[model samples]
Target: MQEYPNYQDIVLVGGGHTHAIVLQMWAMNPLPGARLTLVSPQVQTAYSGMLPGLVAGHYRLDETHIDLVRLCRAAGARFVQACAHHIDPLKRRVSLLGRPDLEYDILSLDVGATPARDLPGSELAIPIKPIGHFHRYWLQLQKRVQKTRAPMKLGVVGGGAGGCELAMAMAHALEEQVYSGRVQIHLIHAGDKVPEGYPLLARRLVARELEKLGVSLHRHWPVAAITEQGVRSASGATLALDQVLLCTNACAPPWLAAAGLALDTQGFVLVDEQLRAQGCDNVFAAGDVASFAAHPLPKAGVYAVRQGPVLFHNLRAALTGSAPKSFRPQKHFLSLLSCGDKRAVAVRNGVAAVGGALWRWKNHIDRGFMRRFSELPIAMDETPAKRPREIVAARGGVSLSAMRCNGCGAKVGAEVLHRALEKLPAQQSAYLLRGAGDDAAVMELPQGKLLVQSSDQLRAPVGDPWLFGRLAALHALSDLFAMHARPVTAQALVTLPLATAEITQRDLQQLLAGAVYELNRHQCALSGGHTAEGAEMQLGLTVNGLADPDQLLEKSGARAGDCLILSKPLGIGTILAAEGMGEAQGRWLQKAVEAMLQSNAAAADLFAQHGARALTDITGFGLLGHLLEMLDGGEQLGAALIAEQLPLIPGAAQCVERGWLSSLQPQNAAAYAYVDNPQEWQKLPQWELLADPQTCGGLLAAVPAEYAENCLQALRQAGCTQAAIIGVVTGAERPLAPVHLLRKADWRELIAREAETVQS
Candidate 1:
């Protein structure tokens, strides 16, 4: 049976703690007619409650973060990995950084706050509010501290609990390291005491913990300027520090005011007791980014977590024409502050208690909260309700079943496909020979030029039809480029899911518009092919090009000493799989998509100019799979791949470690036996990624060692920044396997020698 289309949309702007809860709730009890969408820049959002624990090394990154990608999948929401650049309340549209505007019948915002950077020299200091950015910086700082022989000074600015907790955790972490004695931490705050706003007893307990940890506290120190040298106080006292971490007052994103919404003086979205935007009936705000005008609350994680159920209920009510429920937050909530050394202080209503038991209790509460999202229930595949007898009869009594197949399973009706093609623009090139309305395209070959043909097909990997079409077209053309061919003509093969004539026609038009856009860019004309009905969407293109017979590149042409070059980064396969399972960040998926859509024509031309001996595009088989194909029958010829030199797509390695991979991964990985050191390579988390399948992937070219650097430089100049000489073809003598995966150190001397020769 055909699934009913979603008629209304509910868009969530950020994957904050509240929205994570909403997604969990929605997954369990979804509103039938509403389609949910989440727009966020990250794949995983850090849980503020676990920040200190993560810093203290009590938990891993994945354990302390919510996998927004996977959560969105479980919630059946369209997860767009992009930042909201602007929101037009009047038009009900939210503009994103690099995608189309999203229209919403109901909208919710839970974008958390960032640390205020108003102080002079704040630019040089790392702000800890945007936890994602801070986490990355913290890792790099940790590595720097561990490697330095000289004494290292770290300063934390802000007397609040967040700042204090971070200082203690950082000190605890450094103290556990091998060179812990050389690292010193200083807590600087404008207030006279640390843990400001907490109960007196809580403050005393925190001060004692700081003293025990050898953390020096600088009170009543109003920082006037920050420089690379250190922090400067208004009283002319300067503290020299190698690194400065800011955990100051919260600041709202400036975009809220620019969206024309009523906002508080501090730039937070103004909301009423019902959590609805002050002036916009269809909009709602929650969490730290929102300021409740009736009863302003501290920007804390507890408040955000409590607002989750209220926001979920109000958003659904606002969409369903029901009265919104008012949210009354408790005046005082229990606060547990960790002391970074397996101890914690609990405070409420001016009373306080401290002990190791309190720390254990805090850990249980935080982990229990994380378990809610981390151990989410697997969402069952929903079956569409059966249509009435009369309705089924009108459609010729077709069988009704909810299960739908993907790939060829989602092709459009042949009749519908034909009608759509009849309306497309007619082909205008002489090489077309025969165009649309034909079973298959037949193009005339240019005089004295060799014919080059390549075909590629794939199930829809993205939700946007138009964008998917462009990517599919670009992917199909990559093979021709690998063979050093110039585009001439192309044929389209499209499959679409069951839908009404109007929708089918519209989707077909949009899909072709994207494909034709890319084809036109390469001076290729679309002749025609076939279309059919299926259970899911799929697109394919059979592209033909012209090339000089003698100049064409082949996969079997590699010589023994040629340097191997990869035109794009590895990990698209793993990233796509992670995204499908909702474990990848939106920014990572966006970057992968952009990389997939990039044309390989320029890289191919550069490789050919530099005399590439052998070339092939890395696709379904992956880098190793395609490389093995190049080595198949060549006697005594093997390749050495520097594991570290391989350019990786950002976030790919993390996804692999989390066990997210393509369905074809097992089959691709079976080829790992061809590597010399299988056991050692397999132990690395990034090893499985080598076998992960790719779509519209990069070109793998083997060029003379002398010209490899020039080819790589030209590729980068043409926009292939990740291109690199990953390895080189080796002589037959060292043949335990067809491939050798070596560490970077093992090949550094060889690479240096090659670099000198290239310069000569």
Candidate 2:
């Protein structure tokens, strides 16, 4: 994925099938000088076609969910994991939850509809509009069935095809998975047929299948109200069921109704043949979120999947002033509804069939469709980007782009810098003599205390400037935390790519807001520092703190019996590297982001309170590099670690095995010189993780043996969930190799190995 000079923006506002396919297509044929972004509440989008199979235990999670993070990376798009709360067509901006509004040149909406909540007590009933939320509830239901240790009654509302399939699948799950309990599943419909729009033959076949599977059919029963016990029909007949799965008619999300777009009676966006929102040329819509006004089609996954290519082409056309293409849905398409047990009922053009063969065919088609996103082809265009299209005009023919001059000429405009400074997150400190806008910050030194200071810098890794700012500040603050100091004041040094005055101000404001948030967490005040235009985004922080001489910690005081504890899990570096290459899954990247944003203050304080012998924060050189530095504090003290005891980030092992690593990994390998039998150890994923570079990594401490367990409990209670005891300090047995890396899963085995090594 190459970055070009961006002039126009194309924003996709969902991870639905249509947008997923569009991303896949864009990867193969992207427009130059256009910026792309995706705003989605989820990292993975469920494939509705195979959702029933997934619920029935025939398909796994990965098979039915598409990784939006990977697709965005492949398409050179910025992935924003946040829900869109409002869209302003007139202003050309979309407001997201807890973030700045995103401006767009062209926007498209494919966010699927939620189940209509028309009647009272609908909130009590479990709506299956969002499949992701429904899946979690399903897992809980399975456990509830087993926990009760008795027969249960489950009901599915809506006699539509989705409801019918889900009812049968629920019955099958009870029979196949849970041995301790049985479930009596019921399907309720107000209509004459289980599937409303299908052929008569197809309806008859589906009814027979439901009967054979022992699903109770409540025909002509429209739900009037829901109660604590169960569902009540319009005729006042109530079914006292344990739970209800609502698969009623689709309705637009509440926010969409106020988006100022033309909508149908159901509140869904109205679109013409080209899928462009009516009266809004810059806006487009597809999938369940859009109601085709010319020819109203049923909300089905097949139509959304088919409409993807046309939508993709038209979006590009809109950007380049080319003629747009129109999408025409077929009058009738084949429908394959999964049965509970490896069988499916197929309907097409007044013909219907039921057999196990249909299920196999459906599975093959669904997998093939998924492979388009899972296995993206390699591209040959690795050329360096030409200067981006100008969003702001250049001054005197001097192009202001990724390439800018060095020295004072590259300084940001005074007006842009002033506006950016005024909007920074609130900061206050009594010791600061001057704040931002000064030549340099003047700060009073901490009186009658040991002054602690540290500095750290890194090239921005994540796409979001705000997030990168937050992570960078926390990374720099960890050094002060590890020393058991109270952070007081800090200065920010930022290097951003050259852009227009307005764009620079916006970027700088977001970045500083995030940085100040982290600084404020430690009661640190933001002073002033340098800002310059550069080829890329980067942040550096210089922090000043005060420490009590008696409580101050260093990496040099560990004894032979001290225990080594890590504040967080390893393997974050690998996941980030894989995401950059478009090979990492969405869930994997989410976990990495969460880990990097965590503050180390809590864990450091806990270690200090528990009488930690030595402490250091791990960073670019990896765990082993920092660990070696910690060892330098003592006299030839050796360390022993259990390989399997080291915690790993999700997907880290798979990524490392596939050769996904940060560019700094090779340089960090210099720490491997301390490992015994380096050639043999290098074969394991753990070996690479030991040398993997982390951005906002965690604190590594050596605590006394008696205090290790209590310290761990305190850390977790304070939200250091991944904190654990990984290794222990020991006598200097091997002068050549002081670190003993053993492949043992148990603590006793590690102790036994140390004993044996000492005796030998």
Candidate 3:
């Protein structure tokens, strides 16, 4: 079976190669009755095979990294971008940083070795093990160098393969990027040879290449401490340096030392040949984080790549109650080492070769490996259709869709609702006189305040019910927030897929619990609503709010010359649509999720305080449609938008460039019919984005030109990082029409021509 309402949980703790391969394989062949979840702190995992190429500027960021979010989407797994802080074997729980703990029936660890070893003064220098952090540091370093454009000196503490490659790459790139500034690089090695464990010939070739690239190499110089002045060597010699990086030996993450798993001398998990933890039946580990008890091997990605098939086989065996297979270390494997330029050294079985041809071959091999991740795509699905074996047996082997009941019989049991509500934290409310137990909730409005109500629904965008519930709840409450109303109470309307009793109970518990978590934050009480078993999982909310009539904002009172301000970035719809098709990168989805989770309440308050003339929330209608609504169908008013001024989500531009748009995008584009020469404007990259629908998007407001700058600052102070002034309104001429998109150059040219006409 390819799908099931999971009866067992399988959690993977890292986004390394082993787990990535396992996910792709799972998509091809899935194990029934098991749910897959990946907990990783990063959405993108760097491929070590192409790290040298990336440093050399031969490959782009996307080429050298795997998108974990897309991989999880392809595998039908729930992805949680968080670090695992601790593991409790007895309780079968994994504690996470900044979120709730996860319970697992089976757990796999592939969190690669950490480079933050017990080196003295290591904090003074950047450690290069966590690739994500290193990549960020690398980007910042480039910007700093470009900005200052001054003579600089850089040092690498350990002359391992990583150190040598980066030193050479930096020297070569600086010479090209900042020709005016002289840059010197130094490679200091504690060992006699660069990359101590490698062959002598390979070491000699790497040294020759480093010399050709003008990278100075120092052998047998172990740094004792890093000081403000420079790196102090064991021989009492100090080398002055502007920046230092540590490519030191790798060790297990510090948190693993306290975990209850058996570990080796270096704190790595001890596992059998089958990749299963020693003396543990339900836990397994792979990659550099695990040490095979049968034999010792150097930390390499190839070993993890080799372990993928065995790990997959053993995991399925464990879940299905069958025999498992063991993994064997390859006796001889080829090694490719790249120089800063387009040249590499290949070594195998006492023979070594070096040249640009070797580099091309290495590039081909690396890209081939990465293509496996990019090529896998999945079909969009609303929900898992299959049920556990027990459910099938109980229902006479009929599918859940065929066996589902109708009307009253389909309603969730009252006992289940009572049980789910009991776990919720208390929320005291003065507005709600009665809730839950009666046929209807009775509420009272505050004295002299106007009542505001809005309702919204969304199908499951993610497999994680808890997260989906929170997003859905926020999305529903956005309407009231846009109108400057204070949320007071909410009624949930939930539709859950038919499943076993236990599965249904778990779903409701997680879903409602997440919804209440947000409601409690907003001081809104969850009064009650309805739930029914349906074909798919969905969430809706009917929110009631309170607002002073004089202070309320609306979408119809816009005057000419008003400045248009958007509180949040665009691209939520594009990323979600691409993610559903398994075509989006994990980093893109990360930004989309962050934008969706933001609340527009603060922005609304700022808009009202700054004298906003018109207000609307950018939701399912997209930016253009919502803006048109704010203009009251643009009957007597017109607007001009600066394309370059629009704030966008990180990966949104790329998604639109790739034509990944939501299903509602075409309908949203209908709003552009009100504009002049809309087809000509279609060539702009921001076109599809303006038509991209959003859920829980930002507040779009028309404010006075004088308040625009002050309002923007206020929004930023309140944590609206992407807020910006997008455009202005112009209502004098019918020729101006309802809308017009002006690129920066065109806008400047138009202003020049208008100034000339005024002078005439």
Q: What is the lDDT of residue 480 in candidate 3?
A: 91
Off by over 4 Å in 2: 1-3, 176-181, 378-404, 498-503, 677-683, 745-760
Worst 10 residues of 2 by lDDT: 389-398
Candidate 1 segments whose C-alpha is farther than 4 A from its true place: 147-153, 176-184, 232-242, 379-455, 463-470, 486-534, 541-551, 554-599, 621-692, 702-760
What TM-score against the true fold does each predicted structure earn? 0.77, 0.92, 0.90
Encode model 2's per-residue lDDT on 1-760: one tens digit a residue: 1243345678899989899989999888776556678989989999887888888898898899998888887777778888898999998989888766777779999999987888788888788788877888888888898788566888899888889888878877776432333678888888887777778999888888888788889888888998889998888999998888898887998998789999999999999899999999989999999888879988888899988999999887776667899998998788998987778999988999999999899889889999998888533232334443332231233334445556897788889888888866677897889977777888787667887999999887776777788898999998999899999988889897655565677678778888898898889998887888776788999999888899899988987767889988888889988877778889998988898888998888899999998999888889998888888764878788768778888999999999999888999988777776665456789999999988888899999878988998999989889888898887767756778787765554555565666677
Please report how far candidate 2 places residue 290 from its true position, in Å: 1.7
Model 3 C-alpha lDDT per residue in residues 111-160, reported as the tens digit of each score = 99887657777787877788767877888887877787677777888887
Cα RMSDs of all predictions?
7.0, 3.3, 3.9
Arrange candidates by lDDT, highest first: which order?
A: 2, 3, 1
Q: Name the candidate that leads on TM-score.
A: 2
Per-residue alpha-carbon lDDT of model 1 for 1-760, expressed as tens digits? 3364344568899989889989988887776545678888887899988898899888898888887767877777767767997999997888877544666778999998877878998989989978977889899999898787788889999989999899989878887542355878999999876798987788998999998887889998999989999999988999999889998997998777799899999999999988889989889888998898877888988888888898888877765566778888888889998888888989999999888999999999999998888666544343434333333343355434356565565566567666656655444666887777665667778789998999999888876566788889989999899898988888888877655554576568657867887888888889876676665678999999999888899898886778899999989999988877656665587679878988998888999999998999999998888998887655667888887888888888888888988999999987787887776567676588789888889999989878988888999999999998888876644565778777664444555654554456
Query: What's the lDDT for candidate 3?
Result: 0.82
* Model 3 spans with C-alpha error above 4 angstroms: 1-4, 146-151, 175-182, 382-402, 411-426, 433-444, 500-506, 633-635, 730-737, 740-760
lDDT of 2 at 643: 80
